[model samples]
Target: MGVVNVTPDSFSDGGHWFDTTAAIKHGLGLEAEGADLVDVGGESTRPGASRVDEAEELRRVIPVVRGLASEGVTVSVDTMRARVAEQAVAVGAALVNDVSGGLADPDMVPVVAAAGVPFVVMHWRGFSESMNSRAVYGDVVTEVVEELRARMEAVIDGGVSPEKLVIDPGLGFAKNGVQDLALLAGLPRLGELGRPLLVAASRKRFLGHVLAGEGTPPPPARERDAATAAVSALSAHAGAWAVRVHAVRPTADAVRVARAVEGAA
Candidate 1:
């Protein structure tokens, strides 16, 4: 999966793909870069990010999804709003990538269940505005795994088939640097949730922190491509079902290489 944020405040690529034409171009470019699917978001869920109205979110996303679908691209709508998910699916989104994981909107579970397409549920606490305060965890990995398991049960009870769901560890959301590292180290426990795990650590702040090491300034987003590829390989080896990345071609290449080596072994 590739990341395409059509918002002006996405932490990394804000304002880069806010225009429809530019967003479409970026989506197409991701396709050309070997993305199996492109995950597009109209709202920025970066820490402390403000919410956008429903109409604006729909306006920013639907057209891009339609255009990408027209080109036979697999499109996923990265939204927590049920209304946006319904409209985007109607237009051509094949997946609902909800970072809020059904917590933000009361109607999201039912809408996703009715759609019957793949739903990517990220582990989240409250809305973006307050999630940072919810990051406290006794053991980050175990706690995240437990939280995701609870979410899975809720989603199943809400009528979404377990088979149609995928889980995301939600790398930077509601996590401190130490917590993020612990989660990565314990990803296998997350995989035990009986759902495909989507690790979205590409160009994330945690990766920058890891690379920074000794108080050096973190690498910029564009410069994190190689680091992202390394994380892709790590996640895949740790049994991740997919990785969401900004630079798809390199990560795809890394995944292919890892798979090839695994097969040969």
Candidate 2:
């Protein structure tokens, strides 16, 4: 999956695509760079980020989603709102990538079920504004897996078919560097949940920290693409179904190489 943030404050490449034309171009570029799907989000869910009202989000995203779909691109609406998901699907979005995993909006599951589109249920503790405070965990990987399982059950009970579900461990959401590393290392445990996994560690802070060494300032988001690609290679080797990324080419190449190596093995 490729990310196209239509908001102005996403941690990475936010305002770059805030314009509908720019966003559509970026989405098309991602597809050309071998992204299987493009995920378009209107809200900025970065740490300490405030929420955008539904109306503003709709205004920012609908045009971009519609334009990309019209160009025959496979589009996923990255929204937690049932209404936005519904509208995006109507405009030809093939999937719903809800970061909240149906927690933020009560109507999300039913809407997804009715549309019969694939839904990405991420491990989420709270909204972005307060999520950092909720990062405490006994065993981060185990807790994330258990939480995701509970979310899966809830969505299934709400009428979404289990087969239509994909699980994301949510790398930076409510996770510190150590917890993030633990989750990545524990991908097999997460896979035991018996669902496809989506690894979205593209240009995240954890990767930056690793690249920076101790007591050094982490590199900026765009400069972390190489590290992101490295994670993509590892994640694909470990059996991730997809890696959501901002810079699609390197990850696209990395996953292919990983697949080739695995095939040879």
Candidate 3:
């Protein structure tokens, strides 16, 4: 999966594709680079970011989703709004990648259930503004896995088909580097959730911290693509069903190598 953030404040590549035409072209570019699916998100979920009004979000997202879908792209609408998800699906979004895992919006599960599209339920603590404060966990892996399981059950109970659900650990949403690394190491435990795993560790803060040694500043977001590709390779090797990334080609190459190793195994 390739990421197309259509907001002005996404952590990475925000303003780059804020334009409808540019966003569509970028999605096609990702497809050409070997992305199986392209994810379009309007809201900026970066830490400490404030929520954009629903109208603005719709304005930023729908046109791009429609444009990409028109060109035969398998698009996923990355949103927490039920109305947005519903409209995007109607406009040809094949999946709903809800960062809040249906928690932020009351109608999100119902909308996804009604649409009958695949849903990416991500592990989340709260809204971006207050999320970091809620990152506390006894054992990050155990807690995340348990929480994700509960969410999956809730979503299933809410009328969504079990087979249509996928799970994401949400590497940087509310987690610090230690916790994020723990989750990566614990991918096998996450796989026990009985659903496909979507690893979305592209250009996240944790990777930046890892790349930057202690007492040093990390590189800019765009410069983290190689690190993201490394995480993608590791995640795929560890049985991740897919990886959402900003740079598709390098990660795609790494994933192909991992898949080849898996085939050999």
Best by lDDT: 2
- TM-score of every prediction relative to native: 0.97, 0.99, 0.98
- Please identify which of the two predictions, 1 or 2, would achieve the higher lDDT against the true structure: 2
lDDT by residue for model 1 over 1-265, one digit each (tens)? 9999999999889999999999999999999989989999999988898999999999999999999999999999999999999999998999999998998899999999999989888989877788789899988888888888899899999999999999998888999878887888898999888899999988888888888889699988778888899989989999998899999989999989998999999
Tens digits of lDDT, candidate 2, 142-240: 899999999999999999999999999999999999899999999999999999999999999999999999899999999999999999999987889
lDDT of each: 0.91, 0.94, 0.94
Residue 213 miss distance in model 2 (angstroms): 0.3
What's the residue-level lDDT of 10 in candidate 2? 93
Q: Give me the overall lDDT of model 3.
A: 0.94
State the lDDT of candidate 3 residue by residue for 1-265, as single tens digits. 9999998889888899999999999999999999999999999999999999999999999999999999999999999999999999999999999999999999999999999999999999999999899889899999999999999999999999999999999998889889999999999999999999999988988888889999889899999999999999999878899999999999988878878888898
CA shift at 255, candidate 2, in angstroms? 1.3
